[model samples]
Target chain A: MTSDILAEAMDYIDDDLISQAYSYSRGRPKFSKPLAVAALVAVVVVAAVAAIKYSDAFITAPDSGDSSTTAEYFGGFMPDKISDGELEYEGTPFTEKEISTFVEKNKYDLIGAIAAEYGDFESVYKISTSGYSHVNLGETNTLKYDYVDLPVCRDDEIIAKITLFRSDGGLSYTISVRGKAFDKYNSIYQGNLSAELAFFYYGFEELIITPTNHIYRVHGTEETLEIDRSMNYYEKYATEYNTFSYNELTDEKKYITVKPLPEEQINDGSAYTSSDIEEETAEAPETSTVRTVNIYVEDLMSEEIASVEWGSGYDLMLDRPFRVCTEAQKSEMLRFIENMKPTEAAEPVQYYGGGYIVRLVYADGTRASVVLMGGDQVYFETSEGESPIYVDTNGNASALAEYIVSLI
Target chain B: MDDTSIIKLYWERDENAVRETAAKYGKLCIKLSENILNNKSDAEECVNDSYLTVWNRIPDERPDYFSAFLCRIVKNLSLKRLEHNTAQKRNPEMLVSLDELQECLPSDNLPEKSFDARLLGKSISDFLRKQKEVDRCIFIRRYWYSDSVKAIAEDLGVKEDRISVTLFRMRKKLKIHLEKEGFCL
Candidate 1:
């Protein structure tokens, strides 16, 4: 079940992000015209979309029951003029046919952008994905599509379909602009059409189309007081606290040498030479054992602590080093440990909330460990038994927990 | 006045800081509290409390992001107020948002491990940075601001269904990401 930790975690999001949310709410662009593009792109039936082959791209029109769109003005596709690897946008090579195929395949909802005042259209050398609604097809003159639709983004790839809708079926061309253009166009357009052409673009603004939303329900409870206790622990401590892993054994290694028995000595108790024993010892597998134990809170309350090592998880798996705690803080923690009263409890199955394992090293090279769970409960790892011996610290659980977390 | 100016006033122990902060962010704080409490009076009271808390804490503690710091305090106070409210008085909209986020939790009972809220927050921010701007905007609006799906959709000029669908997909991705990050639900 989701705990308050998740909500608390939201509070911990980068301050700038929280500020960005405010900006989004305050700076959201208000569009003047009302568009009725079906909201759910996933459910929207692809209207009897007819592809009008214009230049190298296929200009698909929503089944607007007009039959007068198939004339010389609606330039047909030039199969022979299909350029091969001639244009590239955002590292993705797009041939004339490829662009047509992409637009046709996705069947992206198209918004009509009526190109105002077309000049001499020369060879299509490059497909610019810049934000400018006006594209220089060739000469100094720019082909301005007053109304621009926000690009459809698919996995970081922006493929925007600009359908050049012309009155009188005047060479209706379709151009594809992909990649970084989406951000650029979105910043400029801000969901508003160009106000320069209020006459033609006014009523046409209702054709603005939005991208489809793909459905995916991908993967969270509370329970009794015990569960609530666990929930409280998780919600309160899991997110607010820091955990440390305690490596119980010191890094010092002691090598031990073992000599194999002589073959004859095994059956007849024959004496083996010291040189032979040395040779066997040299050939034996080298064995090294950890020589020192870290100080535990239980065993070394009176002893001076040399240092402390901590890890995030229980299995001594270190994620990051614990922040250096002051000597006074260490003494205080030791005092808390001394004052802690042993309490009866069930076997420590799992904290299922939050905790850290702390290993204390004494000045005399001895070591001990204390498992701090949910701030209130402490477990002294004095034995290799199945269950941990739990301890209660009266009503100072939160203070102890805070102290433990602070040590991180 | 800007946030820095207001913060400066706080440092100078000038009471005008509270007034300036209220003038600038009172509406936002009230809106945020209202989203959670679903009670205008309660929301206003929480905002006032937040202002007092900020007034008391500041000068001693100067936040880098003054607005966000205030927002966090206000949100915490609002949630606390909601907790104290009776079930009948609780905001169902806020509960719905929380319930929806609950769905993002790990489905399988992986052994619970202690997680740093800051670390998780970083992970979430990283995930959001990789998302589309619109998606990220929608997410922060709904989760951070506690905005309803319809509200988010209206703000973004999209359908509520679209917002719902996008949220669903994002929640799924988040669950997967959290699982991969070794976080237990």
Candidate 2:
């Protein structure tokens, strides 16, 4: 009986996939020309399609007027006759063949161009990965961000695929004009975030990673909540949040340090070391224990008030692709947030459908936004980090955000 | 009616091709389009247009593979709608999805060939077909279907972190495959 039911479900799912396949191919134009015209169009289309093989390096968004794409903005991939090892712009899922082809084609530029670019790039360590990549251009504030990507139909590796950004916005010089390009992969080391912790969206709370690699989950609430070696890491070892390593008690070294979030931390999923749970919990240090999180909340929602002290230890966990913020910076930001007055969030004017998100624009122009749907639940995200924070269903949305701001 | 019967009816120009096609694959198409377009009327229009387009083309062209053919038809129609409705932020289900795949591809121009688009199209399809059913379905749902993180979790009975990790890994796999197929660098 179960098998029969499963079969029916499978059939239904297959039919659905087949039906939805159309949506996957959205944005394609319908071309119905005369047979001869179609024949020509087909040739062109086919040729264009075949050009999917043209993997080239290109640059990504360079703020253009209006909709943002300019003709020159789309630079062509240099021929692949590499005399040296310069990073090549192969398409996503790059095959060795494409790289070889690119290398071979650009080789002629050898000592003259591309090789020199790679040489200069190689002079500095260039790292890239599936997620995002960064290059340390030294104190000069010269940094570049490279995004791995490709466009439709064109073989040469485009340069823009790897997004290069500097804290000082220094990729400003005529790039590639120097022809010194070397690319590195898997360079940035984002610390481990437990898969379990990955589930909670810290909303606006900042993740503080001490130089010792101990990660503190701090939220700037009306009071201030900072979890670290200060009080006790074992106290919350296994509660709404858990941390094992940083300050494992004597025999407690056996407690497996599991990141609260298993997924975000990748391989570090959930670790188990200690034999006794109760003992470890009871031995938490009281002095360093973080109680309140002072948040400099900029935006306060309707009917929500900031609490006076640390409330229930928020079960909130910071989500990754989180852009880690520093303590000093957080303090500066919180002060700015508290002085700000709460304004009525504009009624969501039919944004695509029902409601839109409320955006918080900081004095420095930094922005954080909270999207509250029907149930008053909040999903907080910022322009910098990749992760989003989810506020508790019962907590005051304003208090929750204010708390996070205070922590930031 | 079965899929084969609908194709036959479509070619015969019974004028009820749309109705019959809807009967056979309406919900399926609707759900799929809804997954991507997220609009009832737009999804309905896409399916109807697919039926109409199929009806007009089938009399002259007979396809050996019916499902793939219908899928391609609907897929093209949905793309067209996305382009037409660009005034608003009506991104198709694959907006962020395709972005994930972007990393694995060459960071340059898209490949150019006579049949490159179709080839890459075939490549994606084949790649998808090769994935484990549950994993593939997860990818399609999160991506092609535009299902939210919550929806995918509820339907699959798995944790959201699992889905997120799975997606990240899946994109990596696709990226690796692209390198094998020699698509991007």
Candidate 3:
């Protein structure tokens, strides 16, 4: 029976009708007195906190005419005139004679500080140049402690290794020769180290030694030394406020503006210029040592799978032609590998349910696969004929599987 | 456990009321939540919270139909979770379901002219009761549970286009029904 007549008569169910029927079938439930009271208290507390947090906006605005306090607050830090020049690292501020004299006076305290900072210095070596002596302190076992490698220059070459460690107290540095340059020094001085002799960099070029309140700024060859108060401010606040726009604070006249040097200065033949050093230091590392890795992901529930290969001269995920994984992505992948640890099992546990599968291929053509079934049953397999990994509980294998799944 | 016994357990103020209710309706609650959230953990959390809500409300009021009561609570809780999770973005399932009903519903411009939701629900229910069984089930499954068109088609053993056309025709009939009932959108 075709219902053209009924269609014209018109009346069909809609969302509202369905919702009404359901609701009418289920009578409304009222909350108990205790529950009602608890809910009321929660709402009141939330409202009170929100009101207190936003109450300041409701108060009258500060007097806009008061400019004296604002001026005084900024007067101490504001520069008079800023010059447009590339910052060149001019080495340590101390001369050869001055460094020798300071080291002689504070050698014991310096040695003590180094010992305290890096357990103890097993040996000290020195390399003398025409102007200054390059000091090297070797650790008993460099692998015993965690250290970050910082490049230190000696005789215009980045051959010195500076290991920096940060503890709750402060920073400790251990400067040493890269290879067998320990025999070049005329004498080896070793003693207890103190905090005053710990050297830190102000910028890339300036080496700052804090014996007390005094700071020495050194440059290469040109020794036009000045006790600039602005240098102290630059060391203390430059990083935090270097990009301070004039409009964001006071008028343009109140703040000194340091603009970039002309492009000609950057291109012109200049020895040890900031632009040249930045370009050399910021270049990507050599890709010859990069490992090739492949990740495969499968959704067992849908029986759908996809994979992406990453390495030198190979990347399948990127839309552009012939582009490999970026340095950041490589670092992330390495970090994941460093933290990955799977549980070992005697045999593969069979599960006939749906889940996810993740397979990883290492640089040496070794393959590892993890199958995550329902209820936190994770089975892992490797091509090296190792025992299967089974994680009965939701633990590292489950988390690793999830992380791998996210990568693909 | 049956719905009647679960309600009786609640009436007795026993903690097993929650366990029994969950044993029966947990999967359905999670499915409803997942339909809106599209996330397993969030749906699970919403279902657990809905059970707590039932526990709190059962002492003062006894529901005639416990399943419908639970569905209402879980649906509301899932919607609230959806609101919180997608504050900056819209949930696609929720958007699609609401957009489909927007044609027959009133525009947002008439905010001052508030309509009673329960009254509208009754009028719509009367209209649905008059329709064929297949058409009514399709409409309820689509709008009430926020089920996808493909899911509705699969459940009813029909093609997706047929379900879509049927919904379209039902909407037209609903529009005529609302006009006859003197409700202006």
lDDT: which candidate is best?
Answer: 1
Error of 1 at A345 (Å): 59
Model 3 stretches astray by more than 4 angstroms: A1-408, B88-90, B107-114
Q: Which lDDT value does model 2 have at A38?
A: 27
Put down candidate 1 lDDT per residue, B93-167, tens digits, no spaces.
Answer: 777887787776654364335667778788888877766455676788788878899777655544465466567
User: Model 1 over residues A81-149: C-alpha lDDT tens digits?
Assistant: 112222111112223343343333322122111110011112111121221222111112122332122
lDDT of 2 by residue, B1-185 (tens): 66667667767877776777676566666766665576789988898888778878888877665655665566668767866775454644445555554565555444233224445545655676765444566666665555666556544333455456556656666676766887765
lDDT score at residue B90, model 2, on the 0-100 scale: 61
Going through the candidates in order, the fraction of native interface contacts each one reproduces equals: 0.42, 0.01, 0.06
Ranking by TM-score: 1, 3, 2
For candidate 3, the clash count comes to: 13
Docking class of 3: incorrect
Across B1-185, the per-residue lDDT of candidate 3 in tens digits comes to 87779988988989999998888778778877787788889889999999999989987878766776787778778877876885544347755765676566554565423545555666777877776545565676666767788766544333465466557656756776877786654
Ordering by DockQ: 1, 3, 2
Q: Model 2, A172: alpha-carbon shift in Å?
A: 71
* TM-score of chain A as modeled in candidate 1: 0.15
Kindly report which residue stretches of model 1 are placed more than 4 angstroms away from their true locations once superposed.
A29-408, B108-116
